[model samples]
Target chain A: MCDSEGSCHVLLLEDEPMILMDLEFAAEACGCNALCATSVKQAMKHLDSERPVRVGILDVNLGEGQTCEPVARELERRGIPYILHSGDLDRQNETVRSLNAQLIPKPANANHVISTAMECVGRKCG
Target chain B: MTDDEQERSRPSQAMGNPKDFDDSPERFRDENPDARFGGASEVLFEQAMAQTRMAICLCDPNKPDLPIVFANKAFRNLTGYDEAEIVGKNCRFLQGPETDPEPVRKMRQAIENEDVVVVELLNYRRDGSSFWNALHLGPIYDSEGKLKYFFGSQWDVSDVRAARAEEHYAREMARELSHRMKNMFSVISGIVNVTGRMRGIESEAQEINDRVQALGRAYETTLDDASAGRIEIGQAIRAILSPYDVGESHLRLLGNGIRVPFAAVSSIGLVLHELAANATKHGAWTRDDGLVEVDWQEKGEDEQRVVEVTWREKFGPKVTIPADAKGGSGNEIIDRLLRFSNGCIDREWHEDGLVAVARVPIWKAS
Candidate 1:
């Protein structure tokens, strides 16, 4: 169950479909609505939709030699909080660090993802 | 040891003439007085230099431009230059735009100190081609200890350098492969963990197996055209549903060639598998004469491009909507998958069978 604020919409950007599904399921389990996108372009479309986004979760690699940095920047520009879930652990990306977003490496549990998204929205997980 | 000492240690026959050796007392005593003034030794020395495979050159240090005073046959052959064309020119003529300046600067320092130096650098030939040259240069002094000439020997090492570059590329590829493998394992572990927690062990194991197979199919698609980073949507669907096709006629697939993004292949395969499995148990695939038709097409333009897929089934026993149809796990899985892809699925039940339509955003292959 989510915090007292009921369900808030969270933008989810991940290239891997299964992982994207897992994140969506996690957000739903925590009583949050998930608006998912499998690529940066799709995520931008979601952003442009005027949807009320309380928070965001992003996977670093969007496949086809693309990344989610553009979406992350847009989220930052809008002052929305986000978490980065990535399989690339070796990269010390300055952009991710400078954004001060929490980074959860791949193979993360749904509980952790849910908790991180809740925390980004200023909610506490019981 | 000093050069004089090294010269004296050599056999008198190895020396061209007594005058050619530095005036070390030992060399003077070792020379054959009978042959001291003869030109026979000079001819033998010239023959030896001409026959050797190593490119050899002698540069006159006293000359204003340090011109090459002598060049061996191998030197002429290696550089595609005639002896007459190279004899009076500085060896720097072999350098061109691609040559790195660091080694040239090092060579300059060595020449200033009159020190022996070996450098591997790019050098141009008379034909305007380039070769990796391993050049060794040392000073040759006269009896008075004056630097008379700079002795240079060159070997074409282009093949060796090329091999080293190939080795570097292979190492980079190996690192990339390792990183990808690690990520794959992580994904597999996550699947096992999550599925086990959500379902009992037996069901978890089965789901894990199915998901792994889905991943395998995705990899097969990638291997088909490793460079494209895409797979045909129809091919991916066929691969997943082929196992359940039973009689080939039961399943029909039609599509205008649509290349799905590589990242979406595995998930798409999983969705197809789930749909086919449900049909096999309770839908059209339950009966011998039942039929299913799946088709997909791309619509919209530019950034708005979307893929629309429809699954229509008929000829099975009269369809009945189960009580849990609205909230079933199968529906949940389908919803999650479609939503993740920025798509939606609409399911309609008719007297004949079931119809499902899915519209998903897509990135066309550039």
Candidate 2:
């Protein structure tokens, strides 16, 4: 029952491979096409792609390496909804908190993440 | 009969110590002929009065300015004001700054209304030590049904206050324990998410645990340094990177620098471990000819000093465009390292080798 005119697309930006796989599984199972990116740049590329994504799942800390705040801001500006899934305490900043975005703390199962992402996207897109 | 005569007739010996009252003979001859007493009751009364620990005081109720007519030795000890000073003074002098005003006010109101009162009050001793005092005061009626005197008794309750303090401390500790447990749960969740997505299911859990354990060890080292009031950055680094070192040559530590703060050390350790693990798995040590060069030196002495680290790969399989390149593990690691605005990565992917140069901000040691 996919709606071609307004079918949902998700961008999952995670720095950890295990979490990325879990999210991918969950997104597909929920019948949503998910694009995975390991860094902010890759996520930006996906956004700039011909087929633009309308939603994103960002990990607060990418790894021992990068951050996704800039990408989150851009998504915010583009009117694209996003959720934060992270274990890093630093991500609990004022900007992130004010975005009123959903947070899926680490250790969550695939179903919970995909469902929450769907909810955020549904609320924002609708 | 008069009040004086009524008191004398019942038994003079009931007052305690017949020998001390030379006025008994005068009372019997002139006031009441039936008041003569024997030795036995007097001795018993004196003994009982001396033995009781409760502080007892007898004050005249009618005369607003009436003095304390009688008090036991315990009364003298309790008030720190000997029988001499307190006999003629009102007990209100016992109230001090820390005394609970409501109870004291209630007791005063009760006294003003001539009502019997039982109240717990904070009072001070002669030595200035404070104690919770349970005071019971009642008006003693004469045979004619006139409220003639007030009798008061006090008991100490300092022990109960101490028990309540201990209970409060225990509850605070329980709350702290729950908070710590939540943090631990989040950490475990992160570990599960990472390992669950790993290629080899059998080794995934173990690998995730190893990394978490490394993080835990680093956290402990920082805690230990904090407790000691000093940060041993080099020691913490050495401990964190212990698992990836195949031998001394594999890890060429360049900066034998001064100790860094615990916060910086933890961030740096995590970065080092991730990069080193990559080198060991896919980059240099992927083959026997692999080597990792590690070094750190301060750029300058400003508030924020730039600390640079480099990891160059010597020889390996022509670094295939990582089959899982989009969500490649290495990229994930590098991305996480750059989370701090003070951090950046400039990579050199050339025909000769692969080099990753990272710049991180450092806080000076206090």
Candidate 3:
């Protein structure tokens, strides 16, 4: 897609180490560049660096008992579309669920995760 | 002492000639001041002791048998022994199979050490009836600093202890019931989520979630009404069907308000939601041309006020009643709902429309 680098910059905000690895490989395989953050604070640092990011995939819950709800709210305010990735959508705390985002459950197929991310980016950027 | 002579002569000294020996009150007082002072006090003390509910015993400390020098009516009533039977025996006769040994042992140690003892035990009554007894015993000393006697009192407290236990059980039951209800709600939410995913599209899935969430809300609102022991049918129907309406005009609501019980409100609400959802998808409200007319009125005399809710469809696409589709599941839920209220459902089909009629009782709120 590009001369010698990735096609587009993708930011992923997932907490699990294995899930983060899966997403990075999936995004790179889809001809997109990937930047990973394990928490909302780290994601904000990445966003502050003036890097061009076309899309985001946000894990709704951080394993350390924190939530990405405020991060998702900030993304919505910044006009950046994000897809929700959660394994505990039906079982997690109710307050975190009231946020607005398209939800995709996990241990999801890598292809569906990548495609949903692309679709969300296309909806926001186009 | 000749019996006939003693009977005849006794009246001569004490009863016959009181004026001959001590006619003047001043002379009698001068001869025996202690008798006048002590007899009056002793009679008053006896009167007060007889009226007390607390078991009172006066024990001789010098005697190891602890022979009871005095026992009140309450003591006789508590130990099943009258004055003649108990006055010469040890006060420990009250201890038996029903008596708790720990407090009794502590009480004996306290008494041997000349310390006041306040402890709980089980003591037998006159009829061998056992009761929880709170015993308080203290030593009484004479002016010469010698231990004169021990005074003991017992109280019955079985009813108070039983009432406390009952109260504890009630609170435990309330907490357990609340916990169970919360888990139940979570399980229902899980079912809604899983079922929503199996639907055809996102909108359909969202719709199902919205309706199911509304069902959860309806259950809450109806529970409030049920706790108050009355349910307003019109208010309930408006709340139950709100998710499916989406501010549409083809769904018309017509009914005067009627009150029923919690069971009726819940059962009827489940049945109505099923029918309304089916109608929204297949019968009326499926197309712009279709219409649903809902109405309710009294159907019988006396206490039998039949409230009929009709779901009528007209001018829709050529309709085929899904005999196995909505009918089967909907009827099963409806039957379960009406089992307690003695209700039924009737369906009729004509060339132009399909109609469902639910007849339920107007159970009065208590």
Top candidate on DockQ is: 1
Chain B TM-scores per candidate, in order, are 0.48, 0.41, 0.44
Worst 10 residues of 2 chain B by lDDT: B19-28
Tell me the spans in candidate 1 whose CA falls farther than 4 Å from its real position: A1-5, A90-101, A120-122, B1-85, B92-121, B124-130, B134-160, B186-366
TM-score of each: 0.44, 0.36, 0.39
- Model 2 residue B44 CA deviation in Å: 7.7
Better of 1 and 2 by lDDT: 1
Reference-based lDDT, residue A10, model 2 = 84
Q: Give lDDT per model, in order.
A: 0.73, 0.64, 0.64
Please tell me the TM-score of chain B in candidate 1 relative to the true structure's chain B: 0.48
Indicate the residue-level lDDT of A70 in model 2.
Answer: 83
Q: What is the lDDT of residue B101 in candidate 1?
A: 92
Give each candidate's interface RMSD in Å. 4.6, 6.8, 11.9
Clash totals for all candidate models: 0, 13, 0
- In candidate 2, stretches whose alpha carbon ends up further than 4 angstroms from where it belongs are A1-126, B1-47, B65-67, B113-117, B143-145, B194-366
Cα lDDT tens digits, model 2, B130-248, are 88888998787766777767888888767887788887766555444433443454456445654554544624654554466456646645543454554666666676665566665
Q: Which 10-residue span in candidate 1 chain B carries the lowest summed lDDT?
A: B18-27
Clash list (residue pairs), candidate 1: none
lDDT of 3 by residue, B1-366 (tens): 643233223322422432222112233235325224246665555444556667776677777767776665566566666556666677677667867678978887977999999987877765777777778888987667678778777777778778888977765654444333433443444444444444535345444544454455455445434545676777777767754665576667878777665666666677788777766766666777666667666577547866777767676667665566334555677766766677888777654467778888874533
